[model samples]
Target: MGYLLITGGTGLLGRYLLRDLMDRQQKLAVLVRPSRRQSPHARVESLMQSWEKICDRSLPRPIVLTGDICTPDLGLSPTEIKWVVENCDSMLHNAASLSFVSTGRDAEPWRSNVDGTKNVLEFCDQARIRNFHHVSTAYVAGCRTGLCKEDELDVGQEFANPYEESKVEAEKLVRSCSFFDTTTFFRPGIIVGDSESGLTFTYHNFYAMLQIAWTLKQSLTAHLEPDGRTNVSYFRLLADGTERKNLVPVDWVSEAMATIIADESLHGKTYHLTPRTPVTTKLMCDVIQEVLNLYGIQFDPVPADVSTMSDDEKLFYHHMQVYESYWKDDPEYDLTNITAALPNLPCPHVDSAMLANMARVAIAGRFNWRDPRVAADVNLGVPEEVNQPNVVKNPS
Candidate 1:
């Protein structure tokens, strides 16, 4: 049987992909870093314990291998490397530094996104690999303010963060690889919770604002941001005081990605794995506020004027640098490629209420940032860190 290999096989998106692949009984192999003390297989097993929160019943087990992308050939043992070289048929490049505000220039994105990608491509080349699937973010559109579509490039806008530039470079690298037989690039927009259960693995996307909202519910922070009118799209602006967060469930992303790989018709193209119906930032903020209020916490609505204040008052403004670019991107996808491939596969649901519910659970469950140890006053994500006016980072 043909074997499949995944780089970020343990990430939120990787969990879904692994589940789908295993359900089909596809022989799968995943690259994992050997822990200082534990074995590689043990590390993957520990990871699976965490994945139970997101994966469906169709999930299957994975064959984990000890490897590191930073080192040569994923730090694989000589024999293991040779074995993978001979048996592997398809490769999924999903591992990446999703955090936009990284420790340093190279540490932030260039290494995993660019350098790591080159290494993966090289490994395949040396192994005589055939199929390759690269997962990317839709933020590559940068500051382009309009309907972004799949397979379209060069909008002439710009990127808001270093993460965007890195993703674009990575995609370019995948497209340029000479020996790879089949390549598919999946570009997802502001990925978030599980559509059905409203569950999320990490606290990202609009979590910054929700952090404040969840805090307000507990009478923790006295913040006053816009109540309506948040400019979220090129067409209908989500007025200030309006909070819009476009999020897709991990289940949906993995399912779509798996289906794409299973089908052969789609190769040498890009696919936008975005939510069919995104929630307005306003509704996202409102639900959290109301939920807190229901819990007997007093949360007074801060006027839009005070809400949109600069970093001095709006401490979370720093992190908005990565998210601010999302103000636009009311995309329209053909779906001809996705729907055609997964004829019977069900689409994951990620509407406003669904996302809000998921947000509620994730926040109440783990994102209690108010705890001093959980980073109560860091505010490392303000828009000012973006290094540009309005935009998040400087373009190279």
Candidate 2:
């Protein structure tokens, strides 16, 4: 009678995970923090209603527990704690801070990534949930080149940012917990939109470049020629165009992780949810140029001096400074674990056309630039707009 307890049920991949698992009729419960505008149960209802709109059917809802992962005992009441102890046997830790840098020890990347994970582990120990699943990023390999196998973690490699460093510590903490019967790790690469629909609830990583290109295109309108191509100043990127980045779709990652979790035989091993063949930077730039009708984004083998750069070039670098390390070539990810577990479900190849489609969708949606749509007063009866999953603002 015990159910699987999931954290981060409102995140990008978390939404898809809920949908995929619910489709399989697996008993589930979610731990969600109340937002400023909505209670915990209201947020879960909104998420479920959004998924129902997507599938065009009614789906069973999971019990919602109101709690903040960073708080002591996960901010759960005594009764709620008792419910978890009595009704939950396993857990999936998906909540995390995605900030690339750390402002301070109490600030992001550490607060949510490290401290929050410690709290979750404490709660798990108290609740006695034996099976633990942690969602880690493949970038935990951190600035490492060559082949990064599934079993590899902390090889004295340098990190590109604080986010990677925090996640590595969190994974180590989970592994250090001695009471767990099974420990599983899911490390996914740069996650993009859905393969079939090209729809994404969250926009980061690849979308960052596309958004910059779109803004650049708008800024240099007079430079545009009759052929609709802009004769803008070329911005020199740090890397050559040949570097490849491992990008994977969200749906594929969710499905693969769900499959492994449902089968107890696949527990206790790390799974790399990465693409077989990664996409090159040149191809991504080409797709952006073709979709946005903009050009002059050239790559240089060596770094260019900032003083010698043009105004437009400087502007590009200024905006892209945070994500500078992300554009580097990724290592060949060993998919031995995922490949064997889900032979029939293969990772979708992200070709130029697919990238183009995703770029267009992001551009058309205005890169999810909008005000907070969820109001303080929410009607529980799913409204017409609430029925549309795309319009449902993510609380995370």
Candidate 3:
């Protein structure tokens, strides 16, 4: 009967979760921070409106709590806090910093992943919200090879990046909390765009290579061969063309999580929202080469020698250094919990054609480096008062 309070409602997976949950007629409230250009309410309004346009139906908006997860009480005012205490009984902690590197413990990957989680736990304890749902990455397995079960968290494994390290710490923090009656964790693999639309808002890990190729294509346009292909023959990727990357579509991840969250019996367990069949590096590269008209990229298992590398290859490797561990190979993520929960809902296979479609979409949008800030197309039932910045005024 109480509203489900969620963070990270503006992210790619969060947007899909909002749509799927709203369709199921769930009472929801979202805690979102204001951007420099838009207020929290405005941001949610824009997101909901965008969904409405895409789905071709009117949708109800969640109660927008203007707050930052990194702040105490999530920066909510006394009145806002009272409303949440009275209305929200469960929370989905989804806001996270995806920074792969950390300058210090005080900076990102720590600020949003660890400290932000602590702040959320503190608020929940204060508000007496007992049920908690956490969004974690499957990579928290952290360079561990072979099968990674849903129930496992820490196995004395080493982390490839700071993002994974911070997530492990956050998961430990969440599990350590004793106030919650139910705790659920959804560990999704690399999230790509929608399976059907191939549309995505965020481009980070998987898109890095595609982006690099696209950028090179633009600058090297004059050197294109008669076959409309750009010569990337000198560039060699540090892989055997057999490394598998577990990619889950954002829509599927949202649906799987929503289904589990909606059912009370399904609580208190971990779910690996990953694909049954992982896509290989060769397949991904082939798609990129075909879609982007890139030619002659060799896959070498050994690390490239810096002395013999071309300028383009050097630039590519430099830009991709942060995700070096990410590209190594993904372990097999066990889908025991999610498979049992949603027997009928199978993860869409991301075949080469599908991957190509996704690539085309990204290429068309030029990788969307900046937030487009698309305004609400229809100003339906959004309360006028919520639109004003005073709805949750910043503390003076």
Candidate 4:
């Protein structure tokens, strides 16, 4: 069997995909960028160890290639490039920037998502890799409401942030590339922790809200009397608690994508690895209240101006400004392609119970801020401490 080249093998979904592919005894090559404290090989080894612990079984190791996606030829040496071209027949491009705010035209989200994808495509073209798997996001539908079909790429819609816009551009680049005879796009919804264990390395997006809720609980508890109930009025935009947020477990996405990739007939199609029934904003709020033990939590419309808002409301908004777009209703994602491919495969329901479990895990892990695995070396462009939550790091 020809080796498969995977990028972002250390990321949330990438880790799961690595495990699945390894379990199938597939030979793999992973392109990993060197971190500040560890080499590319070390990072892949650490993640493999974590997976072994999670599964209680040894996994086949992947060949780690030291490279940067934003650079030409993936910053690969002539020997490394030749080795990949000789050994690899398929490429899974999964690395991307998750920053919501754009620093500039040449900075993150744009640099990594757009430029990095172009570089990967160039490498694939040069290497003569015919099969390509592009990991994308369901939010590529952008600000469009209603159902988003699997085949649609650009709908002339506005994006909530630069991240969405960048992904759309990346997908377009992949589609327009003519070197690959078979290309598959896997678009997943908001990916959280594992469904069973709730284990996750990074905490942003949905988890960011949980972190803010934890912060609010901490701040309010410090000010409250010993037996006083913590009551706070939360500010929400014009949402009436009916907006739906599609959340999928990381494991499901990886498994589904792996299954699709293994089947040669399933190539050359876009699949939405999304939930059948999306969780509502109201249900999420109720679960948060239950998990954090907050009483008298009320959601009010965001004022026209921040000048009249209370300090607590202002702090909450400021902390969650980056994810404000997620608070809005998500467009319906059509999963007909996925369902037709695997009729028996069903996406686990992300109900209130699951949300509670995820919240508990986040609270226990402290949003992975102090975890040794994550603390070893934070991803590029992510700060050690984020005073303002207007930026998202390592988005899935």
Candidate 5:
């Protein structure tokens, strides 16, 4: 069997994909960038060890190709290029920069999502690799409030952040490429922890709300009177607690992607890996209040100006401004393609119990706080700046 080459194999989705594919005894190779203190090979080995502990079994190691996605030819050496050309039959492009805010015109999300994709395409063209799988995000629908279909790429809609804009550009590039005989695009929604154990390596998106709620709870609790009552009536949010959020478990996403990848007949199609029953903002707030022991929390529409708001409200909104869009309503995703492909594989419903479990795990993990073992297990090849603190900062 020819080796299946993968990029971002050390990332959250990539690690799960590696586990699923390796379990099938498929030959594999991963393109990884060297870190500040560890080589590419060392990074892959560390990830594999973590996977072994998670799965409770030994897994076959993948061939590690030291390279950078931002550079031409992925910065691969002459011998490494030859190895890929001779042994690799297909490629899975899963690496991406997850920065929501853009630092500059040509920085971060743009460099990795747009430029990195171009480089990967160029390399694939030279290597004569036809079959390709690209992982994208469903948020590429942007600020559109209606139903988003799998067949749609650009709808002339406004993007909430640079990350969404970059992914849209990248997907456009892949769709336009003519050299690839088979191109499959997998667009996943807000990916959270595993459904069963609520275990994840990183925290953002929905988890950001949890982080904020936890911080707010601690802050308010500090001033509680002897009867456990404070002057603060209710914590305000920018949403009315009825907006829907499409949150799919990371395991489900990986499984669905892997299943689609293994079937050659399913190529040349776009799949929106989203949940059928979305979790509501009210449910989220309820769970957060329960988990963090924060009562009297209320969600409401964001005011035009916060100049006249109370000190606590201003402080809370100031810190949560970066994630304001996430709290708003999300578009309805069309999952026709995925539904037909995996008719029997239903997306798990994210209920109150499930949210509680995820919250428990996240709190226990301290929102993936820096630990030597966690670092070794969850490096996504991005810089330290991209891994910003998950907490919402309080204004002085």
Candidate 6:
């Protein structure tokens, strides 16, 4: 059967991408690493079961094969490579490692994010895949902090961490891989949870800050210092005034990407999938406060200053910095091509309240926050950024 070959088929966006194709009557054959040992369907089945509580279960299933992008020709045997060449009509390269901190000296990011692209390209050449779709983070534009065009790359700006650097390089790989008849890249800014439920598959996401706050609320997390203003705080810098964060829900991301790839003319175009009305850090923090209050957690707001955190806490705080700027300070994206392609499809637009509702679902047990370890799966994970409001505990 002709297939839509997808890399990272079981990832956050890959699941949505596969489902979109299936919805259009497209067969999916995703590439999996041989190390998985088990059949690809079984692996995805296990993973989906684990994430079912977190990720939306509306996606369709697909065929899977053990393949690794890190290896030559994606580590596929000559026969397997030829199979794709003749059977797969299009490919979506969505697998990438987003480790911002491990850039300079760490080699894994480059090997997987950059060289992985090279290997995939070689395989595509061998397979002569008809079309290629790549899912790249909008951060690839780097620290330009201004309007970024869909066609632009190598914007003159410094990157915050290795993850950004690696994405930049990986994108370069996709751009140069012009062997396919058509190539398209979709760059999304700081993806959060589902727009409807604020659902997310990965724990490492926009709510990372809230998780930090909840952790610190369990004890002193860190001291936040003043940096600038954001709307949620009413433009009032937090007690420890610092830059506010930017966040976008995941539903918009997956749905928008699904919409973008449907157009054949959009094959070589780049589309920036971002919110029409942006949310600020202060508003994001406010929603965190409400979620905590919803679950009866308490704490006091303190400006977070990494310099003041204990050695162990400092390590955690450092990770927080990776996603901090990306969400709050978004990169400019051109969406004209996408709007032109799908006129009725709603763009991935979101704001603080929409984000808050999603957070509520995540904390309120609409999907299962109970990890089997936490005494109360019912607890709303929030830190004391605002005055601790008195409340009751989870019933169960």
The clash numbers for all candidates, in the given order, read 30, 0, 0, 0, 0, 26
Q: Candidate 3: RMSD over Cα atoms?
A: 3.5
Model 5 lDDT, residue 328, Cα: 69
- Name the weakest run of 10 consecutive residues (lDDT summed) in model 2: 387-396
> In candidate 5, residue 18 scores what lDDT?
92
Candidate 5 vs candidate 6: the lDDT winner is: 5
Could you arrange the candidates by lDDT from highest to lowest? 3, 2, 5, 4, 1, 6
Which candidate ranks first by TM-score, i.e. highest?
3
Candidate 5 accuracy as TM-score: 0.89
Q: Which of the two candidates, 1 or 3, achieves a greater TM-score against the reference?
A: 3
Model 3 TM-score on a 0 to 1 scale: 0.93
CA lDDT, candidate 6, residue 52: 47
The regions of model 4 sitting more than 4 angstroms off are 220-229, 234-238, 301-304, 369-396
lDDT of 2 by residue, 260-305 (tens): 8899999999999999999998898888878977777788767678
TM-score comparison, 1 vs 4, better candidate: 4
The digit string of per-residue lDDT tens for model 6 on 314-360 reads 65446555554444355556667667766676555676678777776
In model 3, state the lDDT of residue 259.
88
Give lDDT tens digits, candidate 4, residues 259-330. Answer: 888889999999999999999888887877778776555544453367876777677778777777777789
Q: Following a full C-alpha superposition, what root-mean-square deviation does model 4 have from the true structure?
A: 8.1
Q: Evaluate residue 97 in candidate 2 and report its C-alpha lDDT on the 0 to 100 scale.
A: 87
The best-first sequence of candidates by TM-score reads 3, 2, 4, 5, 1, 6
Model 4, position 57: C-alpha lDDT score: 89
Any residue pairs clashing in model 4, and if so which? Answer: none
TM for candidate 4 is 0.90
State TM-scores per candidate: 0.76, 0.91, 0.93, 0.90, 0.89, 0.76
Clashing pairs in 3: none
Q: Each candidate: RMSD to true structure? A: 11.7, 6.4, 3.5, 8.1, 8.7, 13.7
